[model samples]
Target: MHLEETETMHRKITDGVYYVGVDDHHTALFENLWPLPFGVSYNSYLVVDDKIAVIDTVKNIFTQEWLDNIREIVDPEKIDYIVLNHMEPDHTGALPKIAELAKNATIVFTQKAAGMEESFYNVGLKTKVVEDLEELSLGKKTLKFVHVQFVHWPETMATYLAEDEVLFSCDAFGSFGALNGKHFDDEIDMRMIESESKRYLSTIITSYFKFVQRAIEKVKGLGVGIKFIAPSHGPIYRKDPTWVIDHFDKWSSPELDKHVTIIFGSMYGYNLRLAHTLKKELVELGVEVKIHNISYSTMDNVITDAVRAGVIVLGTPTYDAFPFPKIWAFVNEMEGKRFQKRPIALFGTHGWGGGGVRKLKKYLEENKFEILEPNVRCRATPTEEERQAIKTLAKNIAEIVK
Candidate 1:
């Protein structure tokens, strides 16, 4: 019904701002690729200032629920501003409908949104373009729009509230899981959210890492203090905003985790043995290690570990003169993400020939990976020398992970 009447919805954030967002518990896939087993949340906010301002809109499918959230705070017709941080359908799919609800609401976004507004929304925009460091006052509260291009989209921006020290980040610190009841990061189980947050960053924000780095730097460069990060997705960061910011900076930067990831595919268990052996060796060397059997794990899961790991060891058997199909698929996906420069250790079992190993070497080399010394090719089984070779490879891999 309405926010004022309902007790379960519309959690308050600070005195003036309230969380007017909805959760999609049924959506199986996000962006039509990544699985959303925990579902996802499309976070919207309501600022009850001298003039009511609504920050971002939700998907068209959730229009009524969203409108109900808005109605709980202030009348939709009384809303004065609708701030759009990103033009993705998830955030703007209901723009036309919302525009109808708040006929006098002004659409505020970055200048880049000008060229693509009509093309994406197909509705005439009553718009005001914000500059690099633009500011607007809604009486006592102030809103600042900072452009963060390629944080998944070119027209992306983040809205900052100077009075409350809250940053309404578009999707910078967002995760994939729906907020079942937990709205803030401190309110939920941090351990459960950590993995989903990493998956979100690795899947959605991995491609634009350079911009992600630049965006964080640019926002911090502004010198405006950020106390709470109310992103348009997932939980808001109120307990410690720096925790998420630090997480973003660490993940977006080139400095990866000091860990080893072993992605392997085996035809007859020889390559499997090689993978486990390397895992044991790396663990003994005090380096964190994660292993994935490609046959059982998805490519997304493999990429999740490999991207953050400083060293990647691929173990697979030759099949039809190429690396195992699953392993090939995994590498191909990582290649699409432009993975490069990390130390790669390759070892596998080949039945009759060594063409698969050579091809893998060339592929990684082409991608400019730093090839470790002695990438051994086991002949269908682990020999005494092959076992020692793997041990040496493990030591080398641990050394480079810093």
Candidate 2:
């Protein structure tokens, strides 16, 4: 079996490395939770040398396409290695099929990932468990592995190709958009990638921010010259790989943008009015402001805005003597995602009682959020006094963000 004498859709990263990933414009939601407005790509790569290696695999649904992509470059049976950097289905979904075809291929991954193979696909294939900073020779090119656990998964790792200087960084520096016809950073609109990358980090990996920081540091410590960063998703960073690296570092860092995000859940128009008024006031004070009605907006965008803002203002009308369920769920997501501690302002309205603001403040405080003063509680509509209190809250927020 040798390289097929056929035309292929696969794109080249360098002389020997090729992009065999597939784009999914059909999956409306990623993980059945986060919205995929721009769709996404399940990236896979092939490095052809004396010993052929296939890094990562596409989603299960695209198994045939993926195999065809590989066959166009080289016979599947000729593949000497099938590397699984993470156990997630999106990356390993084609594993069962590929392992069956690549009879001579050895599946390589970390110890934890090896243990998960059976539970995931039950494919009784030959395996080679690698360790942290381990290196494997592929004739002229060398593959190096780095363990970056809890980078959204317990068994996640990254692979580096020495000769071509490419890093197969599973999901470390990934985004949400599909590559489409363009595969390199220089070939596409970076603005869309930037925004989508932020949303991706916030919704997909924000909970593992600490591990992300560590992973970035670990990759840096490798001291390898990475000309390209081929992840399991999104575009390959070849023109300016450091640009994505800096972005990952900045997003995971403690420093935040000097902006305000107002999230409100209202039963009637009262809380919405309050949220609008607050946004107007903040804008008037020359502070950047983003407002979202949690009931109308999706969680992906809401969480993305919430994570980037320096200050967060939550407004919710009382329901069943508690914060509105939507607002409560948003707050709970913040806690579950381990949102960085930041100053927060709480406000809401009630028909019979005023438990919304109090409950929200308590929960936020318990989560280490710095509760700003003037937890405004209104009844039905805002009177002149309540409006004045809202102004005060806006001023306080402006001072902090500005």
Alpha-carbon TM-score of each model against the true structure: 0.93, 0.96
lDDT of 1 by residue, 47-129 (tens): 88898888988888998888887777788888888898999888988788887778888889887776677788756647888
Steric collisions counted per model: 1, 0
Query: Global lDDT for candidate 1?
Result: 0.85
Where's the lowest-lDDT run of ten residues in candidate 1? 1-10
Model 2 deviation from the true structure expressed as Cα RMSD, one decimal place: 2.9
Superposed model 1: Cα runs more than 4 Å off: 1-8
Clashes of 2: 0
